[model samples]
Target: MPNKIDFGNGSIDFNIETILIKKNNPEVKKLAQFYIQLFQNPNIQIQEVDKLEFTQKNSIILGINERRDAPDRYKIQVTPYGIMVEASQVKGLFHALQSLTQLVKLNPENKAGSIRIPTVIIEDEPRFSYRGMHLDVARHFFSVDVIKQYIDLLALYKFNNFHWHLTDDQGWRIEIKKYPELTNVGATRSNTLIGHYTDRPVKYDNKEVSGYYTQEQIKEVVEYAKDRFINIIPEIEMPGHASAALAAYPYLGCTWGPYKVANTWGVFEDVLCTKDTTLNFMKDVLNEVVDLFPGKYIHIGGDECPKARWKTCINCQRNKRRFNLADEDQLQSYFIKEIEKHLYRKGKKLIGWDEILEGGLAPNATVMSWRGETGGVEAASQNHDVIMTPGSHCYFDHYQSKNPREALAIGGYTPISKVYAYEPIPANLDPKFSKFILGAQANLWTEYIEDEKKLFYMAFPRAIALSEVLWSRKEDKNYAGFLERLQFHLPWLKTQKINLTNAYAELDYTLSKSGDDMVLHFVKAPIKGKVLVEFKHNANNFTQEYPKGDSLILSNSLDLKAWYQLQDNSLCKPIHIIYNKHKAAGASIQFIEKPSPKYFSNENSIINGIAAPTNKYSGPEWLGMEGKNFEAIIDLSKSDTIDQIKFQLYNFPAAWIYPAKEIIVEASTDNLNYEVVGSWKLSPFTQERYIEPIVDLKKNKSYRYLKIKVINHGKIAEGSPGAGHTAWLFLGEITVD
Candidate 1:
């Protein structure tokens, strides 16, 4: 009812009673069934006609329209007697059926069954032949059923490409007949790190976790995707991100001594040797991959290959000299060029991460720009095809909120607005480069993401935003209008059992301050019965006690209230609350504190200090780390007065553990550092945590600095044999009143 469906002719009335579908492909039967189920209305009778000669007077023709010579062309029209639908492909027929289903009423007013659609013409064609969504299955393996479901969702959104990142530093996820070890030994992991990344030695339960897709299973998936007109582009990362391959066969690496499928996330030093054996192994693996995927392009991950190992390897040095490469960078370029040539010879094109633009891009290679718009701009300007997926806008692992409690606690923040507002074409790029630019993609690197529900929660709304950006012109995208559409789709999403977190619900916060009295309020929708609220004088430094007293508890289906007094110009008590509810809830707070002096300092110095971390100081104040379990103690016992605390965290690694748990900041007046001041959980992926404690600080007292204690509720295993589970947390500036 939202919009009227129209064919290119005059408004017509017709009744569809019989459906005749004939095709040699078995998938066509599935398509036919899909259409039948979609349009199963009691008012319209559907009959499957096997032959053209058996068509009834009022039958609809549903088969390939070979005369048109268009694979996806479809025509839906109204005749004097009935509705006629024709297509050149089963997918096209299915699409037409979806359109028809959209036109009919759920419950018709009359059994006579008369439906009318407006006279509208739509000769729709894709802007880019490759509209893709890449999933890092290597970091964490999803079941075959989940993959199929993901495909179905992509098909629903009209996405045509699925770039399956099947191998990486953490694990290998596909079976190769020539190298059975790729799956048998490479697919499994010894242990995954449970906490954020840090120098601290952390440990997990140390259990083995692994999965792989068999050749037969891969074929089934490929066929399933083909029926939906979606091509599966499998990425077999080469030369680098080949820790798993090195682990499976050590001789493949430049070191040729020791390595394992990385248990933790992040780029490792181990890389594929440019030696003959390594190249041959890669060629054999690619040969097997090409047989499985019919997509014109094969992605060879060329991102994040560190030069540390290459610098020291004899074989790498030999390859560098053999290829007339000047340095390691040129060596990498030469290596990629060789692979590109191989793929080209095999009747396929090669695609790589934006890094392929480093030395000199391959002639016909495409680039997936992930670091930022610069790579994409560079690639397109050089007349190379590019797909813009900068981490700022398209990375789904960052925190989506300003509150520390709502983020994934690993990566930087990438709010819904940022994702929705992303323009595939950068403003600075040459206009000519725009033509070379294909559509964009939102990548879900599942290093920390564990389940499908969480994946759906993070993808939707954002995915919807991406879809509109890809399908509609940029000028047509209105934030408010998109929100309205999102509201409507929420119901459908619910029906599909998708767990989507509405960003609007998390933005409710109110603050008020009076003479010695201050108030703060927040609203939230929790799926569980209880949620925790922690109050801290200094959010940067705090600690948590396991069972109780760490946070306050708010109970019942009622508003929470707390009262406190100021002593020595500081709030006598900082209240923390935790509660459980059946549905979503909201919170409010009031406190008393004496006003302190306000002075304007150098904002640049503050910004610079807070934004970047070095050896002398930890990175940005907003930076939050998770990976290894460690206690961060912020000493607030010496400060005169505190106003705000900002944290900067390293970007979450491309793995499933980064999105697994909530990162919290606890505060303590003493170095022993105790009590929860502020807390944040991971919300998909956007990184940045800001906490402004409403409590008053003791003036002219010994309360100086604050401490931060980071806790990881056992999520991911360790990264390597000796490597501890870790996450990076950077600290910037602590603004005080």
Candidate 2:
């Protein structure tokens, strides 16, 4: 202990005097060789040992115990005499070595001297059978080395499933030898989107981009992952998200001629035609995919297949009729079933996004629920295997912090805490079908993540949270303990050069209105670091630090700044929360007609004061009434001479959102009845415009109750996004002045 080195600028190195090995066993021999060369990592080398010598104090002994039943479980005992690792499987030895590697890094001893390790027995095993992490290389390609490093990280965390998202609208990331152009043309794009995918009118960057993994490289990666006890699930998108494939082979698409790999991201109208020739091409491509991946599941993407092309394609309609399919959704089921049958012949199972349940699920298909829990719930109800990867909790591409100035991300928020709280098995599910729930995974959609550093920043910590969620028992999971361990784990990650988000430094705050209406409610996390509050008292520059757990009173305006103060004194970044004391900031409001199920519980825009969600359904702050009237009652607590009330709505022709047909404002003294005060009949004026519709009353009007009713543009017609569904009336803030 006296020769111990400081925490920084030093490491502890140990020399294993001997390693035991069984000459006849292959697994033990491979593990012994790996351990012998592992010293190269710490700049130490030891000669090979032929004998299992436990008499020496510095000797390390490893033995295979096939007596255990568990698959990857292992036991390690470190004593003053020596260290012994016993495993029932080859993977267990690899995992035991990984634990040793972590111990070496986390130890406080110096690299210059030897240290004593206390005698203890440690046993570890994964809770969930399938612990997964996903990477969408199609959006932004990573070379084979990066892929192997990714697998190493997965193995380091004890995750077994590496979901390789290899295909999308933007590009294809895999090679199919039968179809040369699938990699040649399908893997390339004309130009990348200059900014975020949500950028209005969509801009473009100067250079064209392209990348693909050759079949040989992919096989090597597969072998590498196999060595680390990781299974690679190859994703080959089909029927939808196939613009890249259609770009390479136009004859396979519903529409003929001039198709190119999409430079932008989104569900496209172009899809693979449901034709015999197309099926043949799919078979050829899938043959290579099935051969390349030794894993049991082949992910055939059955997500976001816009039926617009299928509805119009003559062959699609004929196939629907011929197969007795009810609609285009059922037509998609036909396509998936065909592919499933092909994979079945190759002795592989078919897995797809929850949308595969649209028409009908294929026999022996697994569902990956990404949109929300309903798909997973439905899949489990029908007795299908389900992997819960809901976007609300598992999507890392979303902005982790509330600050708009953070890295440009796809709209929405999925912070780390939310990811940690995810429960793969829904409680409401009948206990009988629980076995079908095959755990959960975090999805790193790279639509906005263009670089490896950004990708790592987005994936780490969140992925770590996901790792614990899937690996640790529910009773053993503790957020506080996780944060404490993470603090120490970060230094080790920095040593490995893993670019972490340090997302804990991002302040997660919430705002509410105080009952008196004079003071504003502000809440923050008491996490790893300090939560510093700086505010401008009334109207001035932000230079004062407000103490924690105190009310912030609002005057003309309240400009609040909250930062996650780290131990280094240097703040990770500061986030601004400007509350300009709007008239309805602290008003009690009731939703007469609440928003639709998906957007109802979340949107707190009406009373939060901020004019949220300038775009429809773009942010969580908008109260959207899809195909229904948005009727609300704003209780002002007392009668006031209110002159006018304002409303906000966004119109994007593609998303089935439009201006309200009419807005009516009424006033009343009692709760029962109301009299009309003002009304406005309007039409959608522009595409993607945030229209502010205000209703002004007489100056003398003093009322306790204000009834605001906005009619929806019901039932979007055939051409718009989500067509035939109810057109939404997205409302952000309802301010009274």
Candidate 3:
């Protein structure tokens, strides 16, 4: 038998007359049929080949393959009678069948004729060990069947890692054998939030919201994934984000009091107790987890554990002292080390959020750097392996596009391009640290995410971007090419019932000079319904507000949408035009000179808000900015050179939802560019605050634009749900020197 059936090169005396699928597993017959269907070859015969005889022939075999390459490979061998493909498992046989099906093409003359597989010897393996897809069951719990379906999708994509985030402040999704109440009581929520976390006091009536996976179901899923060579890694949150756990067992908290699973998103003060009993409780949970998941790593959520509660807890204080700790921050290290030591004994390694680096990293611990690459850089520099999951790029909960209504309410906008352009490693980091960078992951925190549909809407195109990021080399990530490939996946997504926005392109409109002011408008796609048009000047800064309109219309909508002027008393009102609600619409802006000052009539107004320019100050949107490099281009060709730039920023919502970071500002000559002018760090400010920078600008030398870029240095201090800094940059009178 010959494996190659060459039709193009020359005629070959080879045939795949029969497929003998052998397995002790009872599904072998059904699987053989499936292969036959996949191959689309009705002529080929199927039979239960004997295991010993199949082994001798090196034919199709389905079982665990210990050989490294054999796990997911199809090995074809030439036989005297026909060709035989040895698959380590049924999945490999199915895949080999798919490959064989592709070799044949529909003949034009015959209408249907046998396609040919040319002589070829191909061996393939995954580029990355952990090609993974992470789902945040904490935000919105998917049923076991849904999870299995998700695994099916991962298998389709050839992804091998299924990271199940089972616990969060909002919900605990997996049942704990030792603590049955964790699912029965803790998993159920009174009511889920209806809108974005920024829209506070919008709570629903106490509706019972709940679901959990039993240990048996989890085992089934694990076996299912194993058959496909996919590893399921379960995450059990710890230390800081134990609200759900505390709700079930209040004794686990340092306060030793009740705490509800957090209704709103952001870090909470309540944390796990550092007592011996708490350690025992965690170990017991891990014991169950280790039994269920055979993956090498366990994610211990060591992120966003605020020190406020620990500073006040007597148990934490005692632990801090007992460990010879330097401060309250060190207590987290003490707690993590204890948990890591316990997991080590169970033959599992610890992986945690970058915040685990606060006190000191645990020995042999891997860091998932969510804040930014800084943590990953720090951890990698110290010889600890790091997974770069910076929230700026990897936090899928962030908005996928710049809809001010969505951005202001959801926190900030991370357009699709941003997600695609994200690089796991920062340019500033040493090249040697690259080895410590395992890969990256995207997190879909569900404070705002509620259903599987919404989850898919946010995850697909974004996840597709992340997949390419992790699988392909950095140099290969071309924005235009990626967009093209992304379009290809959209139809596939639709076929799979994924709810995704079909709008694949951004608005293309240019800014033009209109008298003293600049006019900017977009050639919008035809959208149905009343077109609630909104625009933001790269200048105006405002905090989150629900927009009020017809029905609940728009309440507290972003103020950035309205227009503003250098000497305006009234904020420009949003231009709402009624249009057929079924088709996308387009609009334009005509900036006419106003004889009198125009201002926003709303109660919240910034009169005479203009301040001197400074690198230290940022507008409201700049506060929680996190990234390694910041670049902005400000068009100053229309205005005179200025001596100062002023910015106003809102405090981190007391709710702990927004990101916090430092910022750098730059200047540019052509509208196509910019230059770094100055830098600034966020300072403590009550409510709305202002910062100013004094930079020397050449007199009468009008540059086209000014750009401000903010880089996150540390976690924002805990705040109320919507309290994070909302920065506003105001251009004061351009003092021509």
Candidate 4:
């Protein structure tokens, strides 16, 4: 229950009156400064002591021994007499200081109070050498001060790598001395997209915005992170997502000049020209990057480079022939290999997104897998070092809460639970290549994160979970215990001024169905704090806790909200789950045509009695049909009188999820012949909105088998998220009476 004290026997119950430093090291002095800043009593001071002494009163001992076995390992031994920390490296000492900071508890007055900590001999070191976190400043530029704060947070958590994403399609965020236009033109954008990329007819703010890091500023950040034992790995995007660089220098583009920095999100066709001149430009930029970062790895972004322009460009086509490349993909492989060779000349290893694995991987490239675990598995199997940063668990831009009231996110749900549950190492990976799997990283892409506050909101809690994932051994993780510990750590984040999501009011509920009988199960979500839940059934509102060891058997519709009382004596936003009762609520429903992989996994979702979650697309729920009509057979088991059937569909034009063309429900007493009970011509979706289509049942029929058919919208028109691709028809719970 006490702040995790790793090792020792006796307890140290002394107030910090003074710190006796055994070494006159700058890092050790800085550690003392940080400790004083954190627990400022105005009475404590640091004194240089010649000999090591363990006094009981109010003194702390800090010592450095060069003969220590572990270079970055620290030891903190506690006794009733004194608290002593010993380490051979600054990294270990800093970690010991971090532990010391945690021991300084906040008192009732919100001031720091020295307390007794368990006297455990803590000898700790990082599990992985490359524990890292990534930030995409190109999407939305964060100031130098903010970047330092991010690094500070990482250092506090013992994360040692800072992946600075400095270039992307949206903007160029690093200064290149040779190319003044890079910062002057590429870093500046006319405006930004006003909503999620899935929204059709994208709107812009129409305001000029510009930001870039100067060489001096970059040096400051590098030095700042270095003090915390953090390595800054600068990322320079290439080939694809080079709209900004091309906009600055028109000749770098495959097409003509006069390209503007992309104000929108997502991958674009415009790319860096595949020529000697372009290669020179990249090498020049990377040369400047090399001078800035001391880390051994330089990230040349080899992800999401579109080949459309390359297909048309004469120079690219000529290069394809020159290298005898099979296709544009192989051309990309050529590009990456060339750059990797360039970086090798500069004594740095090339690291890239998993997309670099396409066609053929470079001889010594490190892969950062973002799409899924398969890329990491594939890369590692080939004896290449891989960093497992799969988006399902590591993307902080995704929504953390399932509550619709959450801020507009890029999309997809990645709650703290999901991040904490992720295992970076793939089970299918060969044991011979297991050593190639370095570690994992969580990325904070800033397309929707305009301010530092919102950015921290998205990164925190999830990053905290990822920290444990990357640091602790796989078998040591326990969610219930973690939740308990995190509850205590929340205040520390507040003290550090982090804008973390409370999620206390979010509700997690499930529907248990047996035949026609249905029961509602509910619990507080996210933080899972103390909750009092209430439900409204059939227009009657019952406000109180549900009975213990009992479930609510719903005769009709069920509406539930789990409310968590905050410190202000008011409930945060209640997580709302609204479900309508259907005649076939618990009936066995099977889809004749399987749903698309993009939108489904669990086949029981259609008959689980739970409706589709509203916040995002594609969870374990929501059966979606792409370019195929949804035909479902529901077995009511026995003959029952049915009057009306109702179902729901989604309409998001930007995502290419259109309203179904039509819906027809037929009932049959036997398995063969069926009589039409309800039918409707569903309206086309011209805009984005979720719709629940209820076709009034006209015929009164006694039936055992109900066949429901929902027609897909077919091909989406031009200018949608998946334009020219088959529109998806998403089906939720089908309720028949």
Candidate 5:
């Protein structure tokens, strides 16, 4: 937002017959022509004059004054007569033009050849110097044209950095002159995963997909971004996520002679070996990468590198002994430091994922914290620069809404509201180290996103909110006001043929208990759209109409479906909820063991009278624990007859979430002592993904307190996504009948 925006009474009937520039500068004239196109009126023309005196009454003037407070700061003034934009540099002038584009809107009463401009004086500059957005092209390749369009979208929102993820396990997506095999052999995949990675009977498309950018194409993109003031940071994975590169040259791997580019996603056990030959091979690749990109920093993906292969490889073990390293972790650290030295020698700096902090961090490497903020805080505390892109807030691949009708996305939920609320600086960090926080970025990982339309659906609206979070003052944030401005841009986006998602118009709901009664609450969307809900209960169906911000009482168990009727009268995809009005519907739960922060929802989801779908364990309705047991005591408030206890556990080994090893149900009257009513022990080899363990008592019993204990399977077996790590245990709704 602008530091100051003073709106005056009345509006300007801006008949833009001509755009007057201060001098005949090519760059300035080019910008003038671009803004003219934004007007969408052929009558608008550009004129280069020796002096921009603002002598004309109905002309737009673009001028430069080298006295602004900041390099990117600019001022805009609009009166009933004409409009003037002044800035210190080309970047600032570009920003001024963008603001002017937003200020002018179509004339409602008169449909053509003219526009209405808001009369205001505005002064603005960005809050952070490094406002960035990232895209991963290795998983699913996007063409050079689409890449340019992506940069254009970033420029429209005033972002200054574009992180281009060029290489990963799925495929290497950049051309290296000396290493022809890197493209010829490493750039293609055998097949892609059919659906969610955890889907059992693992399916594949069995078709080839491949792409890579040539040197000329990369130069073209670099120049395009340079014109828009966006610096491109190209990522080349190293030490880990190097399966694609290893497949091209098997000599780079610890177990040489045979390798193939990964056909699926996730961490691969094979990585770049620490031997001198492999190190030199990586340096050779970097030599070409550095020549192609003029940016100061290069990203070496130092994440998700497994030590299993390194532990057994002869060369890696020899290198560890030669360096007197304590373990494989330090060997990985050694590998990163070697690469950092190489980049520094090439006149570039190093940026790596949070795992670079593993054994020890490199002396001058900047950290891109993706797992969470702890790594960022630690790096900042050590006086190293950090870019915070935690998965909770910055992963665009996460589901924007709980609407099941939405496109398939990588699991996790990060809505626009969550992205807008992100604060780059950790509140608990020391003030002295706060300067190391370089800003933040949001990553679009593309594992689930397959094409351009799906990509735009996940990026926009959320990206818009992120722009404000990165550029505007913290005090200037008003989501309501932002939404109002976004409405004006919707038409422009459509004109550009961008397939942006209207998540802002989607209805959202919450489940909770109020005074012993379970209630389903509806929150109003930012846009003024009507919401309709349909209920199916007792073999009868009925539809109820309600405006936004209403609640319904769950007096009976039913299948409830709700959707939004947008302004265009198009209904959004409906969200379904299965309500079970059981004896423990609104019960209070006291947890003996709490869930991990990554999967913690509200404390009441277990007894909120709702159940998540069997296959969808990532929703808030399920609580997940990492290598921990589930022990909770539910207070029913009053004694009720109970004969059966039912609950479900999610078992998806591909994702490392395991079913229960045992389940025990007990009852108590005074909350002090408990007697076991039913118990069951299960094997870890069950094929059922959604395990619904049942415990039935021989006779009905009345008790105010019911205790449930679920034991989790320990570490994951030898060949899973998170092998050798503690398994995640997810529990869904619990019902007492």
Candidate 6:
């Protein structure tokens, strides 16, 4: 990720027999020890020398120079004598060591008991100062040791900020000295959710899930991160996502009396009431939190706070009138501003989710835009600092690939390529507002990630690609070169036993329509490999080995799989595709109302000859709209006999997406004077998969135009995910036969 680099003709051998510290700085020596431990050679030893000895070819010289330019800029020169790393600051020196670790391949065995180091001159610095990675431990608590391992990985990639989400409705993972019950009651849930939240007849493990970090443990982690030059930004959710706090002390709730820690995930109606007692309680908690974390900012989660309770509470209504607030949103804003004032008085800034921008943004608040980039762009335009963590590209909890072997993710497709393609600054934003755009961070929400190994599997390789996005210049980015370098690091990660996903090696394909045939184009991999594709078309099976970018034409419905076979005879995981060549396949279609942008897919997904997997409701195969009727017209290009019309609908009420209440199918000869052919009322049911309802026509009829109208389920029923809110309607591929 260096800005400038020049490769030399040959490589030099380094034994690492000793290291000479230019100023004898204890911090530098300590960091050298940490970097040396990464080597595979067990017999390696580090001895500090007063002066650089040119005779010792295996020695590394670390020098700190006076700051005359970028404090994080570092230079590494590998020549015949030895490797010398020079920097204006310790941060730059650490970056150099990280690069050196890659250069030596973790000190692989070489000739004459020395390691072959690439001979090169490199200068590197980060593109953004606020490079960060967020971990949500509240959903699933990880031990302190595992947290340190995560920090180590972040440091290896030169991340500066670690956003530690320590509190949520699921559990509170940080200890407050003044509030003993916060850990005793709020840290434990009665039981954990057994499976996907959308599962029908919800089940639980019936085993207690609990954990919390004592103040001493928090201090330990802070110091550990400090040693690696990583800032730990502790998040203490407030106003919203405060169910755990309310459960700990009932006085914080408007209803008062009793509340239990949420055993399940999603937004809750019970939030901290806007009262003096709750404000003081939150200020006290932040006092303890700010004492533990030395970072300048504290993330006060202000996202997804339902106002159901506030709408009925007398005290909340009184406060609303007293403050002359327009609605519940303004009340929430006032609540956040009060907290921000307290933090500012304590010499700290405030960070909140983009929801804080609802009524009025805090005067001095940094926004973490998770829903999308619109909020970030708005905040930046208002001259407020914004960190772009849009869920589309940065939510690591989403499925990284569509492969069946992948673990259960929250849902959504965010391949590593999409993450790499992300530009922290949106192109549409004005250049003047770019300064307010600090950087971007990836969030690893742990609702689905249960253990440390799964955590690493979800982060790695993708995290590596993110490091380049935040460090290297945008114009200088070369994914092909990054892959070549990543190939070297993957082996080193294996030697260290890091669990990384192999989706990076899988072949990526694009689907399109061409004259009644679906074309699947497989892009070539940068590494040495051959694409192995197998598919069935027209009742004929075909298998072939394609050495490069190749296109396959599918003329009929079938299951297809494609994978990469490396030169070492190892196979990368294959991606499975299901094709459904119905009468409407490759036909022209027009939408009466477009789907919501929040859950949009390809425009032609409905007629692309592919059926959406029932397991996932979001991705390239489904289009979703909120409380809107689905009315579409499909032209078959020529009159054809049609006896049946079928389509799939998602019914995950837990996500507020319900199946259509009724479907009406009509046919026309000249795109006019359509006559109803069939109508069926549906019984929507909550489940993990979609429901395919077929409408059998009264009799066989030939028509060139088909008009399908679907009635959306109204508002979500009480006690549902979005109770009383407009329900979502997700439609899958359409089939006319």
Top candidate, metric TM-score: 5
Better of 4 and 5 by lDDT: 5
Off by over 4 Å in 2: 1-14, 35-53, 107-119, 308-331, 378-384, 511-515, 518-521, 537-542, 548-550, 570-572, 582-584, 595-605, 613-621, 668-688, 700-704, 714-725
lDDT digits (tens) for residues 133-202 of candidate 6? 9999999999999999999889888998999999999998899989999999999998988787766679
Cα lDDT tens digits, model 2, 57-138, are: 5666777778567867777777656677877888888778777666665654624235444455677766678889999999
lDDT of 1 at 355: 87
Q: Which candidate order results from sorting by lDDT in descending order?
A: 5, 6, 4, 2, 1, 3
Q: lDDT of each structure? A: 0.62, 0.78, 0.59, 0.80, 0.86, 0.85
Error of 4 at 515 (Å): 4.2
What is residue 646's positional error in candidate 6, in angstroms?
2.7
lDDT of 1 by residue, 175-283 (tens): 9988888888899999887655542356554778799999999999999888777888899998789988888898898767578778887778788877778888888
Alpha carbon lDDT at 426, candidate 6: 80
Comparing 4 and 6 on lDDT, the stronger one: 6
| lDDT of model 3 at position 319 | 80
Worst-scoring 10-residue span by lDDT in model 4 = 104-113
The better candidate by lDDT, 3 or 6, is: 6
Q: Write the per-residue lDDT of candidate 3 for residues 1-737, one digit (tens) a residue.
A: 11222333433234445556554555556666665564566776665655524433213433335355555555543333334555665555554543444333221122122433344433333333446677888766788877887776666555667889999887888889789989877798877666655444566656677888899999999988876557888999998777899999999988888689776667788888888889899989999999889989999898778788778888878887887999876888888998999899989989998888998889989988887778888999999988777878878777664423332225545667778788776777799877788777777766666677777787777777776666555655677777655544565567678877533343322223333332334333222212233434347644333244322221111222322211112222232211111000111111121111212121111111222223222222122222122233333335445554434333333333232255555666664566665555655552332333334444454554566553433333344442344322222222112
Name the lDDT of candidate 6.
Answer: 0.85
For all the candidates, what are their Cα RMSDs to the real structure? Answer: 12.7, 4.5, 12.9, 3.4, 3.1, 3.4
Model number with the top lDDT = 5
Q: Give one digit per residue, the lDDT tens place, for model 4 in 1-737.
A: 22234656645566678887865666677877667775767677887767878654577788888755677677787767777888887678887887666655522223444667767766666556678899999989999999989998888777889999999988899999999999999999999999888675679997887899999999999999887788999999998899999899999988866788999888887888888789889999999999989889999989989898889999999999999999999999999999999999999999999999998999999999999889999999889999989888899898887667789898878888888898877888988888898899999889999999998999887777888887766767887677766766677788779987866345566666665766666655444445566776768877885446435676766677766665445565676766666667667777788788777766556765567765445655577888899997888889888777767787776567787889988878887998787898865433446667777665555789988899998987776678789988888767676
Task: For residue 444, give model 1's deviation from the true position in Å.
Answer: 1.0
**What TM-score would you give candidate 2 relative to the actual structure?**
0.89
TM-score of 5: 0.91
TM-score of 3: 0.65
What's model 1's overall lDDT? 0.62
Model 5, range 1-737, lDDT digits (tens) per residue?
A: 67789999877776678888867588788878777665677788788899886767788888888765688888899976678888888789998887776565422343334667778999999888888999999999999999999998898889989999999988999999999999999999999998888676788997898999999999999999987888999999989888889989999998884888887778888998899999998899999989989999999989999998889899999999999999999999999999999999899999999999999999999999999899999999999999999999999999997777678887888988788889988888899998999999999999998998888888987998899998899998888788777777777787678887777767768877876778888776677678888878767888987644588888778787888887778776677778888988877899999888777788888888787578777767889989999999999999887889888888877678888899899899889988998887786468888888888965866898999999888877786768889889999888889
